[model samples]
Structure formats: structure tokens, C-alpha cells
Target: MATRAVWRYRAIFAMLCAAIVFFALLPFGAGEGGVPGPDLIVCLMAAWILRRPDYVPVWLLLIVLILADVLLMRPLGLWTLILILMSEYLRRRVDHTEALPFWSEAGLVAACITAAYLVDHLALVLLLAETPPVLGQGLHALATIVFYPATAVFSQVIGVRRLAPGELDSLGTRA
Candidate 1:
């Protein structure tokens, strides 16, 4: 019974992560401008951290983030570190009930992601030979900022599942 339930939820989580990667890869363009791709991990992570930690583990988070990096051709391991750090940070804060509202979670996720983007882009600018297009980069940041809260809203809708007590014992232990 335990194993079946575990596998069922694990499969669901995998599918969600896969969906995130798929959506990330899809060319969903915005009007005339570039379409804002769905940032699955950010939205999912925010909700999962607050409500479904038992289903989404650090390992899976790292894997999804790495996959996103590879799919986006970003600096390898950068997104993994950022997402994991944000998840763990939010996890600890949740214990204290720090993020009590949707906007609060959105704000936190946006700040962390923005910082990560800046740091990653700066490093690439300084260390890599290829120069990124400044205008496109700026627009991407603007789109991410504008769209982050909507992702959080969707996270609240889709990722808030209740876990039975002690059902999450293993998850807690791993954390």
C-alpha cells in the first residue's frame, strides 16, 4: 500500500516536472514580442514548498532545474542551485509561517530568481566569449517579473495537496 501510493505520487510529480520542461521548450510567444514561456519550476516550487513538500524532494527539484538548464542552454547547474536554494530557504521559512499570503511567496520567488538571473548573466558576460543581446535580455527579465505572480497563483491552484500525517515521515527525515 505504502509503495503504491509513493510511486503514484512520484509519477505525478515526474509528470509535472516533465510538463514544465516541455512548456519551457515550446515556443509560446507573446504578441509581436517573444512569448513568455511557462516557468514551471518556479510556479511549482513555490506552491510545492508551501503545501506539497512530501511529493517534491530536493533530488527531483535539482533534476528538474538541471533539465531546465539543459533545455534552455543556460549555465549548467546554475538553475539547479538557484531553485534548490530557493526551495530549501522557503521550506525553512514556511515552518515559521513566514509566507502567509500568495503575494508574499510570489515576491520571494521573484526576488530570488531575478538575483539568480543577474548573477548568471553577469558571469556569462565576464567569463564567456559570446555576448548576449542586451535588449532581449532586458525584455526577458521584464517578462519574468511580470509573469511571476501569475505562476504563483497557478501554483496555489494546482500544487496545494494535503499529505496525511506520518505519510510524510520519510520526506521529513530526508529533509
Candidate 2:
């Protein structure tokens, strides 16, 4: 049962990611309009991982991140590496963060996203890659941070909420 549930949510995560990427890539003709939009995939990935780390296997995440880089034309492994690191970071802290108040958890999300964005930007700058101005990237990070709570709520609505202490063995018995 635990394995079944994990696979089900894993599929959901993939479908949702595909839809978001498709929608974002749609030719709305806006073409990088005045401001950059929030990185919704990153927000959703972070929220889901925080809630249920086991649902998102590392190999699965790598596949998705690489797809994002190729489809979204990001700096290949650069953003992928950053996101993988962020995911692992959150995964490791899941127990501690789950116990905190919602705002505190959201703050941590913001910090992680912000740091990821900053690191990504710095790497691009050092490589002399063409990137949008810092202001634009900052806006993107801000928008992503702002949307985190909504994604966290969405995660819960989709049954990926943080496991209460009582849920132990509800997932599966410990060895």
C-alpha cells in the first residue's frame, strides 16, 4: 500500500509538472513580457518534497530537472544542480520543518528559493552567460516565494501533507 501510494503521487507530480511546463511554454506572444513570472515548478517541487520526500525519488527529480532545463532553455545542469541540492537540503530538514509553524516553514521555503536563485544567477554571471538583469531574476524569485504558501496548500489538498507523528506506520512500519 505504501509503495502504491508513492507511485501514484509520483505520477501526479510528473503530470502536474508537464502541464505547468506546457502552459508556461505556450505561445501567448507575451515573449518575456516586462516582468518574469514565478518559477512554479520549483515552488511545487519544493512544497511536495517538504511534505513527502519519499514521493520524489532523486532519479525522478533529475529527469524532471533536466527536462526543464532543455524545454525551458535554462543553463542545463546549472539550475538542475541547484534544485537537486535544494531538494536534498529540504528533504534532510523535513522532520524539523514539519514541526514549525506554517509561516516559519514558508520562510524557509523563501530562503531556499532565494538562495537557489542567487546561486544560479552568480553562476551564470561568472560563466558570462547572457541572463536577464538581477532585477528580473529577483522578481522571479520573489514571485516564487510569494506563491509557496499556495503550493503548500495545494500539496495538502492533493494529499501530500506532512506526516503527523501519528502517521508513522500509516505509511509503513519501521524496520
Candidate 3:
């Protein structure tokens, strides 16, 4: 039974990772009079989904980020690093907090997503001078903010539970 459960987790993890990559590739509109593309919600969802870092290994996260970079033709290692950083930040927040309500969690998710965008987009603009239209950036940010509730609803609807007892042995009760 333990073996089956382990395999089940592995399968689910793989599926979730694939969904992240696929969703990242989707041409979701950035709103009116904008690029009408580029979805950052996937990064937030990936971070939210992997609230348990153990379930989503660093290597696997790196691979998925790399795939996203290639699919989006973005600067290599940019999104990969952003995802890793956000995941680490979220994990640390989970460790420090004694209790977190739904709204707080949703807010953190939105903040992390916005942070990732600000860091990456600004860096890209400074380094490459790409300067994507201001309207597009505004639209994307708005879309991400709007996207948060849907992700929260999805997690709740899917009965997305957190780490099991023994799974957090390394981090102790705090985590």
C-alpha cells in the first residue's frame, strides 16, 4: 500500500508539472489593446501547487522553468530562477507562520506572482531593453491579480491538501 501511494504521488506530481508547463504556454489574453498573450499565472500556480517543496523537487522545478523559458522564448534561466526563488520564499513563509487563512494565502500567492514579474520584467527591460508596451504590462499585472481567486478556488475545489505528517519531519512542526 505504501508503494502504491508513493507511485500515486509521483504520478500526480508529474501531471501537475506538465499542467504548469502547458498552462504557461497558453496564449491567455493580457486584456484590451495589449499583446493578448503571455500568462504568468502558471508561475503562481506552480508555486501554490508546490507548497510542499518535497513533492516538487528543485531539479524538477528547474526543468519545468527551463521548458517554460524555451516555450516562451524568454531569456534562459530567468523564469527558472524566478520560480525557484518564489518557491523558496513561499516555503519559508509557510515555515514561519503559525496559521494562515485563505485570504492571506491568496494574497501571498498574488504578491509572489507580482514580485516574480517585477523582478524579471524589469531585469529584462534593463538588460535587453525590450520595453514591452506599458499597456501590456499593466494588463498582465491586472490579469494576474484577477487570476488569483480562480487559482484559490481551484485548489479548494480539488481538495488540495498540504504535506502529510511524516513528510515534514525534516522541517519539524513549524513547517
Candidate 4:
């Protein structure tokens, strides 16, 4: 029974990661202007991390973020590192943050996203790569922060509920 539950959870995690990558690669209409893409992938990742960290193990999160970096053609391991750290931070705080008001959670996400972007920007500057305009990065961060609530709702609808303390065994528990 535990083995079956573990497989189910792994399958769901894989599907969600694949969905994020697939949707990110899908082209929008030509009329769509601006930053070129929404950070929906990050939003979903953050949602899953905050809501159910056990389902999103550190190794799996690393694999997904690295895959995203390769797919999105950004600097290798840049976002992987940033998001892994962010997810770890959120995972540690999930117990407390889950009890806070929605807006407070949003604020937390916003701060993290902003920090990630800033780090990316600084990395680009240090590397002397031609970076996108700051305004566009700002807009992208805003979109990501704004999209968190929707992603959280979608995650919940898909049955990824926040696990209470001592609820690990409700599914196959993870270390």
C-alpha cells in the first residue's frame, strides 16, 4: 500500500513538472508582446513547494529546475540554484506561512521572486551578457507574483492540499 501511494505521488509530481515545461514552450499569438513569457512555471513550482513540500523533494525540484534552465536556454544552473534555494526556504516555512493570510503569502512570494530576479540580473551583469531591460524583468516578476494565487487554486483543485503536522503518513511519507 505504501509503495503504491509513493508511486502515485511521484507520477503526479512528474506530470506537474512536465506540464510546466510544456506550457512554457508553447508559443503564444504573434500579437503577444513584452517579456516573451510568463513565469507560470515558477509560480506553479512555488505553489507546490509551499503547499506540499514532501511531494516536491529536493532532488526532483533540482531536476525540474535544471530541465527548465536547459529548455528555456538561460544560463545553466542559474535559475536552478535560485529556485532550489527559494523552494527550500519556503519548504522550511510552510508550516507557519500556511496559517497566515493569503495576502501575506503573496507578499512572501513577491519578495522571493524579486530576489531571484535581482540575483539573475546581477549574474548577467557580472558575466557581461547582454541582459534584458530592467523594466521587463520587473514586469515579469509582477506577473509571477500576481499569478501565484491562481496557481495555488489550481494546485488545490488538483488535490495537492497542505499537509498538517504529523500528516506525513496520510500518503507514502518522504524523508
- The numbered model that scores best in TM-score is 2
Q: For residue 72, what is the lDDT in candidate 1?
A: 78
After superposition, the stretches of candidate 2 with alpha carbons farther than 4 Å from their true spots are: 29-33, 169-175
- Please give the range of 10 consecutive residues that has the lowest summed lDDT in model 1: 166-175
TM per prediction: 0.71, 0.92, 0.73, 0.85
In model 3, what are the clashing residue pairs, if there are any?
Answer: none
- Residues 1-175 of candidate 2: C-alpha lDDT, one tens digit per residue: 4577788999999999898889888977335656677888898999988888878878989998899889988778999999999999988888888668999989999999999999998898899999878888898899899999998899899899777675752356321
Which of the predicted structures, 2 or 3, would earn the higher TM-score when compared with the native?
A: 2
lDDT of 3 by residue, 1-175 (tens): 2244434544565676577668756767444564543354353344444454444556666776687678768778876788788877776776543256767777777777778778878888779767667666666766776667666566445544566545542234325
Q: Considering every candidate listed, which one attains the maximal lDDT?
A: 2
**How do all the candidates rank in terms of lDDT, highest first?**
2, 4, 1, 3
What are the per-residue Cα lDDT tens digits for candidate 1 across 13-55?
6787788677666776463555444465666676666665666
* Candidate closer to the true structure by lDDT (higher is better), 2 or 4: 2
Runs in model 3 lying further than 4 Å from the true structure = 1-7, 17-50, 163-174
Return model 1's CA RMSD, one decimal.
3.8
Candidate 4 lDDT over 77-105, as tens digits, reads 97789888898888777878867987898
lDDT (Cα, 0-100) at 155 in candidate 1? 48
lDDT of 2 at 37: 74
**What TM-score does prediction 1 earn?**
0.71
**Which pairs clash (backbone N, Cα, C closer than 3 Å) in model 1?**
29-35, 30-35
